[model samples]
Target chain A: MNASDVVTVASSVLLVLGSLLTLIAAIGVTRFPDLLARMHAATKPQVLGLVLMMTGLALSLGDSQLGWKLTLVVLFQLITAPVSAHMVGRAGYRTGKVRSDLLVVDELTEDLRAAREETDREQAGR
Target chain B: MRVSGSRKWLEKIPMVLWLTVLWVLFWGDLSLANVLAGALIGLFVMTVMPMPRIGFEGRVSFIGTAILLGKFAVDVLLASVQVARQALRFGHDPHGAVIRVPLRSHSDLYLTLTAVLCSLVPGSIIVEAHRLSGTLYVHVLDVPAAGGIAKAKADVLAQERRVLYALATDADIAEAGLPPRPWKRGRTDGPDPTTAVGPSGPAGDDQAVTR
Candidate 1:
């Protein structure tokens, strides 16, 4: 097969893989037994899947400029995805939405409780 | 000096550099036009997305997270069939159990994701969560057996493993000192209509599994 044909085949493979991975995450978002588990499935799949799929498309684009733009969009996503996840997670935890019984041990419990107690003590002392 | 929260973005310089490199690779050319454009876009985004002041954990690995996604998919497909069948068969007061699951997650993000995934499945729902105990209370729509006391517990543990199995660092899950889905044979003093001695005694494991 010619170089372009080979590239096309490779890109197709990547696209399929990426699509499948993304579907799993989406299903995970749907089927995971709870919120904590679902989060793992959702964010990671989305960001990585998009990057892979975008990579394939970029290769197929046949233009350095358009490829760069697509790459830029992917780059922007990689940066922002975690930040957005962080924000949502914090809100979920603070709001008491994440289930914790599945956890075997909680490393953050002591520090978080201590800080909360300290804040309450300060308020009471005031 | 009180750390100016504004300067926190400086800490992200490394991430920005990494992102810029990705842009270049994806674009496949280091030509001036692409270079300038990528730089401009990265800088503009960085300037706009204000980082939160947080007692943050360590970095997130895209590769590790991707692996977690694969595991979640397998679990979901399996769970869907389980839930759908339960919904269709033996309709009355389908026994359900709500059990608390806890995990030693590095960040709240991980914890929330776990909860969201579980709730999406047809049978399970997360009703309450406490970050203090890191406890999540979930109500399953179907019980494992008429006397589903065993299934109740198993459901909780099974879901727990599926979720934590994906994201928990090996050390974290192990250190978390979690449990396997041991049948609550003895501790099951609770009402289990699915019990072998119960009216549904002739039921197979599949029927015996649901509440």
Candidate 2:
């Protein structure tokens, strides 16, 4: 297939796959109980879906400039995604909203408990 | 150069070149002025881009954000009519239950957007979103007899995440995937996760959820 045709076909396939993954992820976000669990479902498919769709579009349109813009679009995506997820995770934890059973280890809870105890002792001394 | 991510300036190289090439393509000439202007604009954007860094990563993509807005508009329009009808028929019910549907998204930005989108849907006016807690306390205008409390909350949570996904940076989602998947999407976590403190931390107040 020509590059355009190839990109068109691949993009179509990628978009289909990406859309499916995204739908599943979104479903999990809603259906899955708890904030952490929902977040787990929310982030996975979004990046993949964007990458697939961008690659597809870059291929479909051979406009060198637009393609590069799309590449920039992709680059920005990589940088921002993880940062956002981390924030949500921390917020969930701080709020005690995380699914405790699923968590293998939590350094945060220990730190909080220790800090609270220290405060209690200080208050008692005062 | 201790930060591994900072060194990946090359990762964005393709995008920059792509932009330069785009500038050339758009101008359709190798004029000195065009080249200089394009280079200047490109470099300026690149320098400014990294200045704002949330501890988590971000992957900016306009295509996706646009896609999401399209979906939100449709949902809002449909929901608005439904909510209007309920209000007209039943009058206002102040007794509507307040729910705290927590989401897994970690950022103040995403949570805020999700809250705003939920409130915009007509039936739900988000009363408060404990940013520190990630819990959205939304007042559902009409509580369904069949669904009860859990169902009402579920409906709102599901819709909220759809909006969140629509707005979140694609990079945020992908990096979150680097870790292995947690098993089973079953069972809601309980209210053991309550008790609010300050809405945001000292440094992060600017980005915390507003709605």
Candidate 3:
């Protein structure tokens, strides 16, 4: 096959795969047990799906200007996805919405316990 | 080396170049006029909003960076498949855990990179990062056994080593207590792996029960 034909095949494949991954991510968000797991479903496939979609578009368009713009989209998504996930997870933990049954190890709770005990000791000493 | 005097401007070159490239992309052109305008705008933004200096003391190793990128790409693909399989299966028990991984590197840049990398992968998401102690609280799906906790900590340490080799300075390496060369085969022992005190019961039991 010719180069253009190869590009067309690759782009089509990427678009299909990207959409599928994004669909799975959506299902995961709804189906996952806890907030943390939902966050995993929310961030991972979404970012990768976006990256794949952008890659497909960049390949098919073959325009330098458009390619750079697509790159910009991917870059911004990569930078923001984790930061937003971090914030949501932290918020969920603070609000006690996170399912502790789902978690295997939770050091933050221990830290909080220690802090509370320290405060109690200080008050008793005073 | 301390950034002071005119040399401080040199340090900002990477940011300026990145901003200029972003501007060019936004404008959808790479003409001489666009380039000049983009650079000018970049300079204006940098001067108007001075960023906090988070001492980025690291040198890029081209080969190391390339390897890390390749590994990251592979990890993303593999983890996607794993997560997808778990999501697709019917009545599969979702055993997620939040384990604490103490990092060797104290650098904020390293911690940020580690968190970003972990979150990007499908199974694990960094819930919280303690800046003072350099510990990452990662929520990972499917911890079949307690050994999984150790494996997770090891994976984070391996990632840190790759990042250290790719961009950390000699002093940063020393401060992180890493060898001059990246550790091979997960040989570099990390700090104690702290297990999560998960709420009693399997995650599947709580699947439909919402807070």
Clash count list over all predictions: 56, 25, 6
Looking at model 1 chain B, which ten-residue stretch has the lowest summed lDDT? B202-211
User: Which digits, one per residue and each the tens of the lDDT, describe model 1 over residues B78-114?
Assistant: 5644543433343233344445455555446455666
**What is residue B73's positional error in candidate 2, in angstroms?**
34
lDDT, candidate 2, B96-138, per-residue tens:
3445577766677667667655644444545445678777665
Q: What DockQ results for candidate 3?
A: 0.60
Interface Cα RMSD for candidate 2? 15.1
Query: Each model's DockQ?
Result: 0.07, 0.03, 0.60
Per-residue error for A35 in candidate 3, Å, reads: 0.7
Lowest lDDT 10-residue stretch of candidate 3 chain A: A101-110
lDDT of 3 at B174: 76
Error of 3 at B105 (Å): 1.3
Q: Return the top candidate by lDDT.
A: 3
Model 2 has an lDDT value of 0.54
Score chain B of each candidate by TM-score.
0.51, 0.50, 0.80
Instruction: For candidate 3, write residues B68-142 as lDDT tens digits.
Output: 899998988888888887778758757888878889988788999988988887788888899999989888877
TM-score of 3: 0.86
